[model samples]
Target: MDNLVSVSLRERGGRFHAVFYDPDRGQKWRTLRTSDRREANKRIRIAEDLVSRGDFDPWESPIPDRYATLRGAADLYLAEREKGQLSRNTIRSDRSALGGLCSHMGPAAKVRAVTSDRVKLYFRELIDDECADSTLRTYHTRFKHFFEWCRRERLVRRNPLDGVPRPAVSDALPRFLSHAEFDALVGAVYSDAEAKARGVVDGERSKHTSLHDGDIVWLAEVFFVAVETGLRRGELCAMEWSWVDMASRSIWVPANRRTYSDKDSFGPKSRRSRRVPFGAGSGTEAVLQRLHDETGGKSGPVFVGQRGGPLDGDYVSKRFKEYAGQAGLSEDYVFHTLRHTCASWLVMAGRHLVEVKEILGHASIDTTVRWYAHLDPTRLNAAADATFGRNGDRLRQARCGGR
Candidate 1:
């Protein structure tokens, strides 16, 4: 470890950088990690060693600065995420939440200067703005994670986020459409656009042909598949034609996403999400299969973009909302509602909770149970009726009447 001091750098941002020290006439200045004293000093030693071996083309780090800005850290995090070793959605969320912090603080603000008071204030502002506790918690979680990453990278000496309390949201059961409501929504989709308040279609063909019911019908179909299959939005969008066997009444979820570098990247937000097994009636599966069969075969996407490309999840949600509106539903009831509805309906039909959990592809039966706990009352009522006896009163009356 050579004594490091007297540094000078001409530029800062990726690749070759030179920091000079000692006698100034060394001429061969070593590449510094960054202009920061703490960073340059730490790396100067390593660079000197690397120089001795002639492998001195500096390490080239994703971290631009030791104490990085929220945006910079998130960018680095995203780069690491792009390496395909972690969940893409998780990294995406980290970027989004951390970027929100950058929006509050200036983009170039340093992470070391962040304080517990500032974090507290941010959460308070969230409350004042009427953000949901769940959403607020998401922001805090992202912040906490960023700070932890900072600690590992030695950006800060101590974790200011350590004592921070997390916001608690009620783990309420999901609300789903009733059977009649589900049917009404389905009917609205399969019915006339004008009748369903889906408005009208464009083009000269408007004089005769109508396609208003198409949107709702499709949404309903998508909804049914969600509740029945318990597939996430990302999983549902990735479905291919070959994955469905309507005659056998099954949909195959590959549990992978097509990445920029990797093919069929592991999916479903987890390694366990690698596959989904589900059954659908010919009414839903048949139509989807027929559409693909009519066009080509099992090679292309089952659900395609307007230009016949892969369907993005964002686009699907937008379309799902517009289609759901015809059934007099709110944005509160999005595509995910179909998933809840499926679990709720199954519980209502007297299926076992454990069975429901497995079918839904939940990480734990506890999660499945928690999400549908509101449906427990229905389960309990039937259970009580069967166990306590629907004829308990009759039996008691016979004794009272001295029969």
Candidate 2:
């Protein structure tokens, strides 16, 4: 056999070993199958010849063609998702969760290499980093869906997430602004606009655009409409002049205006379209009329940027936070808090869950109940009185000698 540079022999425990440099396994040192020195040398030469021929792959267990890296499978999964009717928001969330996983486990790490233990550890790290349990649960769901897809695609032998437990999320009620805080926020918004108009507040600009007097006033109007009609921020931004019916005193939330993108128009979160009527003497009609007049009855978006383009959601959220803070609201206050506030106030005012659900354009009544059920203690109390009140009173009289 020809001499090989990377092959050598070593004596250990009275046995001759053939040691060779394997590009894949780093270095291979194995006892020769034969005890004879000539046989061990021959084996070493054969290994070296394979290495030189570029045909040696020393991986003990070879990866199958079905195995895919996390990143590779995610690309396939997301491509599949995009081809379907999945919302852009859902796809964005999936991408975000996939990014996190790719960061934790190397992007090139095989999907089959992931185990339940790794998933548990990843969540542990997230919790340690102070990620909310709710957020962790979202991550868990994204991973679950990804793994399920991988299993169906045969990219993984089995779902690594099978035995992994979902992170427990709290059933805490959504936060909403109080009546006093709501009033304060409104005042702050209007007052800020007035100040900017009067030159008292000068050169106050947002990252996206300048906060003009009209923009501020429009935002205030948006706030009022949000409180009255329970429209989401994106919905408000997507609202067109044509959707408003002054004669009928109603606003149509078209199914097409749900998404918030760089486009001129987008769709709503709920794919279904519905109408929200201005309540009898709710004064919401007046707010819409004034907004229409203030914006010069534009044919396009009711709320626009300084350049009269589609309103930037981030700008609105930033201004909302600025005004909310000035109102002395809690730090956790966000634009969505207004929607929560609307539902809470409705429930407190004795509106039915179904009514709130319709106003909010929720897909189901259960969603409305889960968020606002705690606000309706009166209704629950009434039910309790109807079901157990008399029976409990009789039992109490029996125990207390009718005292």
Candidate 3:
């Protein structure tokens, strides 16, 4: 008993508890859920063996029935999410979405008590609360993971969310700026830059133009780069000077490394690295060349704050909104619209979906096609012509004459 490395038995709440030290998690105190001393001792030995093998998460492996509450399921799910190497954003979002569920159904609600009917009713209430369909779908998606974990762990006989229907998401055409609007937005930024250079001091406008003159010019270039490369906001911000291959006129988007982190551990959302070419006529190459000259070949972020830290994505978005407003664009035109604008223009210019998919770094051609299908004039025309071209008149006449 003394050799078993801090594993000991104790009595708590009329049950024997297995108490031990877990280096990864601090001191762990688990109820044996049995009054028998022999069973408690055996459990302690098992825990010691599990810890030695480096597979001793109290939340996983040989899951116990006591962890059958909604709260327990959530804890276990989040624990697994961490272990599965999910991104921080995904883990944070799951916790938030599931936290709402635990609050609605008391935390103590049994996993076995969660029926499909109960899930359906919960979504009905969410719908009535004026939650957006997309938001409702997200909650449903989170619960689906929880329920699947519960079923796999045998906490529930079946996934209660299995039969629950997800909210129908409307595939509205993505909001994007037209070529004219994009030109106007970029022009506005440069216009302000010109005024700043000329020392036209509009006191109130100064607050809005607080970014350094160089940053204002860079923002204009960012717009050009975004439209040319179609990089995600984070990908663009996380970009480093080294990743920009000026000779090839390409930027390499590295997989899963946080450019904003003190440590370079956080990566791209796509979890994959991709090389995006700067468009031939977008003038992005020249802009990047100027940026390269300005940065003096030192390895740092491609975009940085005035104080010399990496540029924040949110701040960039806020400034873009201000720039768009100055150009008389709609409030709904967001930074992401730059991406959509690029994709739209590509399809409009008769580029194949495969080409668009590669440039945008989309995982699937279906995704590229779905979003930009409307902009592809040839796709629909080709489909119609495939069945109705050249021989269609002859076929129609033969059918009528034969009848």
Listed in order, each prediction's TM-score against the native is: 0.72, 0.72, 0.71
Instruction: Write candidate 1's Cα lDDT for 319-380 as tens digits.
Output: 66766686687668877787788788778777788878766767677787777766768678
The candidate that wins on TM-score is 2
Worst 10 residues of 2 by lDDT: 58-67
lDDT of 3 by residue, 70-142 (tens): 8876876787686665556677779998888878788689878889998888888888898877788888888
Per model, state how many residue pairs clash. Answer: 2, 8, 6
lDDT of 3 at 255: 76
Question: Residue 207 of candidate 2: its Cα lDDT?
Answer: 43
Candidates ranked by lDDT: 3, 2, 1
lDDT of 3 at 397: 96
Instruction: Tell me the whole-model lDDT of each prediction, alpha carbons only.
Output: 0.64, 0.76, 0.76
**Cα lDDT of model 1 overall?**
0.64
Q: Over 4 Å off in model 3, which ranges?
A: 1-69, 107-113, 187-211, 255-272, 379-403
Which candidate, 1 or 3, would have the higher lDDT against the true structure?
Answer: 3
Per-residue alpha-carbon lDDT of candidate 2 for residues 1-403, written as tens digits (9 for 90 to 100): 2233356788777657666564544666655433457745765676656656656543342212212578877876887787666666678889999889988999578888789999989998998999988889899899999998787655667887788988775977799888889889989988888776655654554344345577577677778788888888778777888888877888888886344456323466668898987875665777777777777665887766767666877788899999988878888998888889999999999988998899889998889989898888999889888998799778988989956
Better of 2 and 3 by TM-score: 2
Model 1 misplaced stretches (Cα beyond 4 Å): 1-67, 86-88, 191-217, 256-266, 273-282, 295-297, 376-403
